[model samples]
Each structure stands twice: as C-alpha cells, then as structure tokens.
Target chain A: MFQDFKSDPFMFCIVIGVILFVIAQSLFFLIRAVKRAKALGISNEKIKNTISSSAVFSIAPAISIAVTVLVLSVALGYVLPWIRLSVIGAISYEVPAAENAIEAAGLSSGIGADITDPKIFTAVAWVMSLGCILPLILIPLILKKIQKKVTGAVNKNAKWADIMAAAAFIGLICAFLGRGIAGTGELATNDAGEKINVTIGDGAGILSLAAIVSSILFMLALTLLNKKLQWKWLEAFSMPVAMILSMAVVVLISHFAPGLAAIEWRY
Target chain B: MMKKNRSYIDSVHFYGRIWCLLALCVMLLVPTLMSLHLKAWPDLGIVGKAFAATAVLFYPTAVVEVIAYAPLLGAGGTYLSFLTGNIVNLKLPCALNAMENVKVKANSEEGEVISTISIAASAIVTTLIIAVFVLIFAFNPKFTALMQSDTLAPAFKQVTYSIFGAIAATYFVKHWKLAIFPLAMVSLLLVFFGSIPIGILIFVGVIISLLGAQAMYKLKWV
Candidate 1:
C-alpha cells in the first residue's frame, strides 16, 4: 500500500500540472524580457550571451538539485519531492520539514518509514507546503513597496546606488564564503538527525575549503586567459566553466587522493 | 514614431502581480488537491502542529530572503525566481554573471532586463533538468542509487563552495573597500558561532557592508 500510494498516477498528474505552470511562468517572463531588451536597443549578442551562459551555469546546479530529488523521493515518493524541490522547496528546509511533519503526526516509528496511510502522507505534504508559503505570498504583497523605498531613497545618488548594489552582492557572497571556509561548521546532523562533531581542516571542512580555493583559482585562470588570448566567449561563461572544472577536481580527489581541496603539510 | 508603450517597469509589475498570484494558488493547490483525490483528510490538529514546527524556523528566513534578493533580482526576476526556487545557489548567480558579461550595473535598466532574462533562462533549464531526473528515477531505481552513492556525493555537496568561490573572486576584488569589513567580521563571527543561520548572517553582513560603504562615502574614499 505504501508503494502503491507513493507511485499513484494521480499524484504524477498533479505534479506535472504544477511543473507546466512554472515553466509557463518562466516563458512568460523570458519572452517579455527578451522583447524588452531588444526594444531597449540591447544587442542580440548580449541577449544571446545571457541566455547561453545562464543555461550552461544552470546544469551543474540543476543536477545537484536533482540529487536532492532522489534523496527526498525515498520517503515522500518521486512526485512530491519533484514538485517540492523544483518549486520553492530547498534542501535546508524540505528535509527537516518532511521529517518534522512525520514525527509530529506520530505517523511513523522513525522518519523514512514507508507512509502507507494516506492521512499521514497528506499531513506531511501540508506541512512542507504551508511552511515555505510565506515568500510566495509576501513577494506579491510587498515587493513593489520595497522597491519603491529603495528607488526613491537610493537612486537619487547614482554612485551611492551602485555602491549599495555592490555592497549587497558582496555581503551575500561573503556569508557563503564564510560557510564554505567553515565547512559544516563544528557540528551537523547525520541521516538520523543526530548531532555530530564535524572536524575542520580535515574531513568535510577540508573538502569545502579546497573546492572554494580551487574554483577561485580556476576563475582567475579563465579570466586571465580570456583577457590575454581575447577569448570573448570564455569571458561570459568563465564562472560556470570554472565551476564544472572544480566539481571534476572534487570527484577526482574523492576518487583518488581522498579529502583535501589543496595541498596539505605537517610541520 | 512608435508610441512608447507602458514603461517596461510598469508593465512588468502589471504582469508580475498577476502571474505571481496565479503561482501562489497553484502552489497551494498542490496539497489541497492531493488530499481531495485520495479522499484522505488529515487531522486539522496534527496539520497545525506540523505546520508550526517548520514555519517558525523558515518564516523569518523567508522574510530575509525576499528582502535580500528582491533588490538584486529586479521586478520580473523576483516573480519568476520566488516561484522557481534555488534563488541564491543558481538564479541570482546566473543573473549576476549575465550582467557582468554585458557590463551592466544593478539598479539600472540594463541590469533589470539582464537579470530577468538570465533568471528566466535558468529557471527553464533547472526545471527541465529536474523533470529529466524524475523520468530516469521512475524507470530505473538502480541508477538512482549510483547517483546517491558516497563517491559522488562530495561533488554535489561541494557545489555551494565552488559557486560562491567563483562569485567571490569577482566581487571581493571589485568592491574590496566596501567588502573587507563585512567579510572579515562575518567570517570571524561564523568561526566562533558556527550554528548561526546563513540567512541571518547575510542580513547582518548587508548591514555591515552598508555601514562600511556609508563611511567610505563620507570620507570620499569610494
């Protein structure tokens, strides 16, 4: 019954319907943006570069997300995880949300238990859906107001406006950089949701640090080569290209040397 | 002369509102319709408890994310990204890369158009990739195990590092003066506080950077 309920055709139909709607939304915006770009006299080259680069960059990240789909599918089935991950659900939230929903409802002995009962399944789905529903509702409600405040306040000084913009991006990047440098940071949960010590300068920490540095170096090399060799195409796609190469390095290190994103030494 | 149509920004809002609202309904309908089809109604009491558990942690970050990302994403990009998810890891970076490619500044007309275009392109590719994964998993369970294996999980796990490292290379150098203070402070704080949510740290980092920028502006160093 658990397997039958999970693989139900009705669920697949619903997920497909949601996916189609999302794709339609994307297309709606894509076409409008392209038309507007041309209308604004943006060159075809620029538009093409944006699309090609974005699409290419998306592949690695998309696959990473697909992996989350596989993980979540085990418990929730393919369709629920599919809809969740593809539309508004993220790894940091979805796993815990699903687990909590199950435990809270007293539906299973432990999480990842085959949820045979439809009531339990529905309850889990409801929590995951409703919990992350804020952004979807808030954006439409308040985004324009937020934009108006920024525009009215900051745009008066164009230099300041650019500074604020760069500052925002910098802040975001720095937080992620700190985390990358920190790895899972002292502690993280295992599959059983048990807290465990995560050693830095070794284990997961070393790998994360290594990946970041290697990726930055790759980007630097790509940027230099693009400038020196005048590889115009590489200029646009350097980041994604560099990221793919870095992921390869990770696979290689894990496969061969094991751990360490860079060379290590003992004094 | 062709009559200038509704300003692109205005029209974007007009359409963005409609589409986002439609998406909200569709998103809500996922659980709503599923239960109806199965004829299985969950206990409302159990549902409330489950919702509260995740909501308490996620809601604050949701507010931070919408505020943090909306400015950078522009109007159309905001609507599309909120629906499509993975904004930080994929869409935002894609948009930034696109604008960087064309030498456009955020908060400009070119930036708005570029962000929307790249985010849209990214959203399509991501959805298509996930759909393909679903297809493969449905047909072949064995292959899914290989994908979920320990050997390759490192590469997937390290994705965030690689992406941010690549991005940091661009911005850290470009905005060194404005970035240094926040980067140093946040990295230092994170080393000590390890459990601090990245979302909250991002909000704090933004505040620090803004303050740093303000000081630089006052001194005319920027």
Candidate 2:
C-alpha cells in the first residue's frame, strides 16, 4: 500500500506550500523595493530595467538548479529535493548531508540506490532540512548588525565604501575562479562529509573551461560594444546574454566537437 | 535628495526581520509537516546522530558565508538572499549587475532598493523555474532522461564557471589595479596550498580584496 511514499501526494502538498511561501515573500519584497526605488527618484525606467534584466539573468542559473533537483530527486524522491534546492540549500552540501543521514540510518544513498524506504525518507529529509538551517537562524540575528556596520562605513567615508564594494565582488569572483581552476582542496568533503583530497590542477582539467572562456569573451565584447557604440540599452542584458550564449556554445562543443567539451569536476 | 538619517535602510531592516523570521518558520515546518503527514516521527536518537554529523560539516560554512556575504548583499538583500540560497552563483551576480547597470554604490539607499528588487526577482524566477521542472519530471519520466542527455550535460556541468566568468569580467576589467593583487594572491595560494576549504577561501578572498582596495586608495592609484 505504501510502495511509493516518497512521492506521496501529501508530500507534494508540503513542498508546494513551502515554495509558495517563498514566492510570496519575494513578491512582497519586490513590490516594496519598487515603491521605495521610486521615492528615492530612481527612474521608473531604471527599476523596470533592473527587474527585467535580473529576471533574464536568472534563467540559465535557475535551469541549472532545476538540474540539481533532478539529481537529488533520484535518491529521496521529487518533493524533498525540490524543497531542499529551493531553500537554504547549497549544491555542495545537500547531497553530502543526505548521504550522511542515510549512512547513519544504515542505508546506502549512492544516487541510484533504491533508498526509498520510509525510514530513509524521514532521515534524508530531516538532515537536509536541519543541516542548512543555521543560516536561517543566524541571518536574522546578525544581518542587521552587519548591515549597520556597512551602512556606518558608507556614511562615514563615502569614497572608501565605494572601493570596498568593488573589492568585495572582485575578491569573490577571483576566489571562485581560483577554486574552480585549482581543484577543490583536501578539506572539501565528499557525499558523506568525509574530507577528501583533490589534486591542485584537477579542477583545471574541466572542459567547462570552454564555457568560462566563452563567457569572458562574450561579456567583454558586450561591454566594449556598449561603451564604444553607446548601446546604453544593451548594458543591462550583458550578463544573461553572456551566460546563456556560453552555455549554448559549450553544448554545441560537447556534442559536435565532443573533445573540446570535456566534462570534469562538475561541482 | 538626502535625508538627515538613514530611515530607508532602517525600514529595510524593520521589514526584513519580519519576512526572514516568517520564512524560517515555514522552513522548519517542511520537515515538521512531513513527519506528521507520514505518521513517522523519525527516531529522535538517530535523527540527532545524523544531524550532528551534517551540522558539524555545514554549520561553520553557513556562519562564514553569512559574515562574508552580508556586507555585499546589504540588509534587505541579505535577508532575502540567505533564505533563497545559491548566493554566489545567482543572487550576488544579479544584484551586482543591477547596481552596475543603474550606477549606484552597493551601500547607498538607491543601491539597497535596487539590490532588493533584483534579488527578489532572481529568487522568484528561480523558484518558479524549479517548480515547473518538478511538475514536468513528475508527469513524465522520460523528461529526466531528456534533461540528462549528453548534449545538455556539458552546459549543466559548466554553469558555475559560466556564472563566475561572466561576473568576473565586470569587475576585473574595470578595476584591473585592485584586481591584480587579490587574483594574483588567490592564484599563488591555489598553486602552493591547493587544499583550502571554499568557505575559508571566501573569507580569504574578501579580506585580501579589501586590503588591496585600501592600499590602492591610499596610493591614489585607483
């Protein structure tokens, strides 16, 4: 009678309910920000562009997250992964958290295994939910204090704040790039939270380098075109266009020019 | 067009706390509702054991991320962003792009509003896409195989690099002076150590870049 409890109807209700809550919260903030943007005299045109371009920018990345849902759905069923990927979940940790929980429950959850037992379901869901909940708690308590300091800095030294903002993103971009190229380190955990060693250049071997290079070229081209040609409207679309085009280029390379699209270290 | 005090930023925190707290409740309820609906309260001791293991690995990562990202994302963005997740790959870039397009400082009133708008848009779009994907996968088993097709796998595999590369282009090209120090330092570290945790790397990344920015500012080079 309980053959497929993992995808049970009741489970879908809970997942959908939580997702709806997220959408509602997002809408509330969106509307509030839009109204505030206007009072601040940020042209309606600017707000509109930000919304539209941000929506466009999100598509390729969101599709990739959907792919994560597909991957995790195999072990725990669809609803749990859907919820996990949607909220407070990072791709790096969700799978490992489930693996750890299942290992504790004495069941193997190696992606394709038949881990649909009810006990396994409860265990995976609980761990995936609780494991990433700290941010939910800590963000509320500390974000305000953190934001205060940032605002204080900006108000105190306007020039320095601008430099700090620029520095913050540059550092993040380079760090992620280096991490991607240098390979995830020994401290990086595997599916069950065990530390694993990775060769320094192992992450560099990714044929996905095609996508990175393509994105760089595409973005630089767009930026240059915008500046030289004064295609002011084109500036907002650059990030999304570059990302989507880069993904498309890699897809073609992998299929037609297969060797050029070597798939390595997807994480 | 200026105010005596930062009331708007304060209101952002005001409304932000309510939204974030409410979201947390719903998050906790996902598991709570599941156990009730299934009539299967997981054995407390086992749940505890597994949680302790997972928590040890993730809890520190979460703390580090919050500290690193809060300043960049601002009050409203941070509140909404941490709840929605996928900060670096998605939200951070979206907010940055929006601010760049509009030409505002990240900590300014206009930047805060713009950041909130873009992040909220990004979050909604992401949730909606995943929801649609879930429905399709549930209705049609073949859809999974189609999505997993070899033709599309490469794109999925390269999504992060695609995102970071695109985001990096914006900052590095414009701020080459400031970019040089941190990017070089990261490269040196990756080559020499090759094994730092990403959470720690992020902390390192933000610190060095700030230092780089400070040094350049003092030198009047930027």
Candidate 3:
C-alpha cells in the first residue's frame, strides 16, 4: 500500500503542495508590506514602484518553484512509466503485502505497529517536503543582496518593495484560491460511484465575477477611507485581501458542499 | 543619438550575455539528446514522452534560435522575444535582473520605468516575429512536407505555437491590466481548438492588444 503511494504519480503532490504553501506565506508577508504603504499614503507612482520591486523580489521563489516543478515534471515523464498499473494492483492483494513488507523493515524502531510501520502513508509524503520555511526563508536575504546591488547601501527602493510585496500577496492569494481547489480536487474521489470530474466548469465563473466586483468596491472604499486607514500599505492590501477572502470562502464552500449544496453557493 | 545608441550596445555586456549564450548551447543539444533517447526507447513511458516533448520545446536550442536570429531579423527584437518566451511564467527574477540593468543607466524613477517598458516592448515584438516564422514554417503543409513529412508538421506546429503563446502572454501581462484576461482567453481557445498556428493567433492578438493599448492611450487609460 505504501509502495503504491510512492509509485503513484500522486507523489508529485507533495512537491507541489509544499510550493503552494510557500506561495501562501509569501502572500501574507506581501499583505503586511501593503498595509505599511497605505498607512503612509504613498504616491501612486511610488506605490507602483514599490509593488513592482516587491513583485520582482517575490517572483524569485515563485519562479524557483515553477522551475523545480517543471524540471520534476520533465523528470517524471522521462523516468516513470506513463501507463498506470493502479487498476490491476487495486484488485490484487500485492498492495497490502508490499505494505506489510515495508512496515516489517521499519520495525527496528520498536514502536507501536502504527507508528513503526513505514507504510503509514505519511513517510513518502514527507520525502519531498522541505520544511515550511525551506522555500521562503531565503527570500528576504536574497532581496537584501539584490537591493544592495541595485539601490546600494541606502536601500532606497525598500519601501516600494514593501508595497509591491502587498500586491504580490494579493495576486498569490487569488492564484491559490482559484487553483488550490483544482489541485485538491484532483485527489477528490466520488464516494457516490460517480465519475470524478474535478473541473468547476462555468459555475466558478460566477464566483470569479463576484470576487472581481467586491474587490473593485473594496478598493474604492479603501481609497475613500485612505486617511482613516492611516497605513497606506494596509489600505492597499484591504481590497485585495477582501477579494481573496471572498473568493476563498466561495471556493471552499462550493468544494466541500455536496453537489446540490455546492450549486447553492455558486453565485 | 548615435552616441546614445553606441552606449546602449555597450550596456548589453552587463546583461550577462554569457548566460544567454549558455542557454543557446542547451537549445542545440536538446534535439540531439531527444533523438538519441528516441532511438534507445522508441516506446518509452508517458512520462518519458512528455520529457522528450518538453526537450523539443524548451531546449537551449530554442533559446539559441531566438537569441541568434532575433537580432538578425531586425535588431535585438527577436532576442528579447526568445528571452520573454523562455521566462514568461518566471517573471520576477527576469524583471529584477532587468531592473538592475536599467538602474545601471537610468538616473531617475521615470527613466527606470521607461527603460523597463521599452525592453518589454522590444521583447514582445521579437517574440511576435518568431511566432510568425514558426507558424508559417511548421503549420503550412507545403513547408513541413517539403522539409520532412506531413506527420512531422504537427510536432513542429505544437512547439512553435507554444513559444508564440508564451511570448504573447508575457507582453500582454506587462502593458495593460485588462489585456491579460483577453490574451489568456484567446490563448486557451487557441490551444484547445488547435486553431491556426500559434504565430497567427499571437499575431492577431498582438494587433488587437496594440489597438487596445492605442485606444487606452487615446482615452488616457494608462
């Protein structure tokens, strides 16, 4: 059973999931930076520069993730057998036997069977998993080096980078909420003996539209409340966060709900 | 003006033309590797086939092809196109490196933005040119059949268009915020429909985006 998981193409899931996790944290940092800009009431040009710089900075990890995934994807195609043996193995007892063998090999720990079992399903899941900060921890130090080289000792563009980071956070969140469902849905099974089609189709279109509308409204609101929001970065981040949260809620509700219940939250 | 042009040429040195050259060598080697692999395992697994296909598309040869001919086609336009297509999904690092290059020459914030925009424009134009070439060269039955065979045409077309789509997307995302939606839609449609070669789709999209950008200029949308 554990070997099945290791051999399955789903192994790539762990790698991609870790990448998404990094993306999520990066967005949070971006939000904080945007809030800072809103408090200061920076100029649009300045805001844009900040956003663009931070965007550039944030893009590094995202690119690394994409490149790593692409390379891994290529590696998968090159080394792995394309035709899945899952169907045959599912009906056979070989899967469970293999699982037991692996567990026996791992019994040296002398722990409980559940814990000692290498087939616990979580071992292979953790193989490609870099710790949470593995991807993101280098970003600030990298940015600082880049900043020193670009703007010199003064760190002139640091503020602008902060603002840009906020915008990136918003973009990252939007991507996460939009694609995360699809990603998770790939693993989703139809317990009811139905065909598992993960695509949300034109249904999610309505949620996307609402997200856009609410975001625009939120941005306008933030602009109007600019002075009250105090922090320019906070004001900048609010519209995007509001939009992201709204979309995330819509997607999560739709995904978790049953078919009939899912349709209810579509709009 | 002459002196400024000369200075611009000088600055290309700072852009790490060496890395660009390395990318070129990789493009050339990819096809050879693919052919060798194909000979070794004609019926490799699905993953294997995917790798081979990706090699054809993203190989350093493609990069080299763009860098070598893009400038020769007109100026640095094609080189930028190749660069843009190669880095489309990976924008941040590309942009930051580009920003560093701009900062080397630009003294003011406005100058930095302008330089960045100009590089972007040139990149788009170059990619458009390559897309046109690939589409016409690969998709046209006459061209494909004459060079290789009819069956080879589809493979050629796929890679050509992939590059075209990638470059067009990069350009669209940089200029107008709204441009991304339509460009993305068109790209999806093109990919799904296997419509005319990627170049033709991108050519059409580029024209439309240009018109839109011009209209925005007229309406002060920028």
Q: Which tens-of-lDDT digit does each residue in B84-188 have in candidate 2?
A: 898988999899899989998777778889999999999999999989987887787798788888788668867878888888888888888888889889878
Cα misplacement distance, residue A214 of candidate 2 (Å): 1.3
For candidate 3, write residues A1-267 as lDDT tens digits.
223322233433332332233233223323432343345453455545445432332222222222222122221221111111100011012122222322333422211123322222222111111111111222212322332343441256543332332222223222222221111122113544343545432222333333334434544454456667576554423322333344344344344543532331221
lDDT of each: 0.82, 0.81, 0.30
Worst 10 residues of 1 chain A by lDDT: A258-267
Ranked by TM-score, the better of candidates 1 and 3 is: 1
**lDDT (10s digit) by residue, model 1, range A1-267:** 224786688888898898899889989889988998998899999899999999999999999998888767667778888899989988778887998788887744434556778898889888888887788789878898988877876658878888888888888888887777642443445676676755423233656777788899999899889989999988989999989988888878877876443332210
Weakest lDDT window of 10 consecutive positions for candidate 3 chain A: A82-91
Highest DockQ model number = 1
The better-scoring model by TM-score among 2 and 3 is 2
* Clash-forming residue pairs, model 2: none
In candidate 2, residue A107 scores what lDDT? 65
The C-alpha stretches of model 2 lying farther than 4 A from their native spots are A1-3, A184-202, A263-267, B1-6
State the lDDT of candidate 2 residue by residue for A1-267, as single tens digits: 124788878887888788888889899889989998999899988999999999999998888898888777778778888888899787778877887777788764455465756766786788788888788788778888888788788889988888888888888888878776764433444677455654322255445467778899999999999999998788899989999999898778868966544544522
Structural similarity to truth (TM-score) of each candidate: 0.93, 0.92, 0.34
Which is the winner by DockQ between candidate 1 and candidate 2?
A: 1
Q: Please tell me the interface RMSD, in Å, for model 2.
A: 2.2
Q: What range of 10 consecutive residues in model 2 chain A has the weakest lDDT sum?
A: A198-207
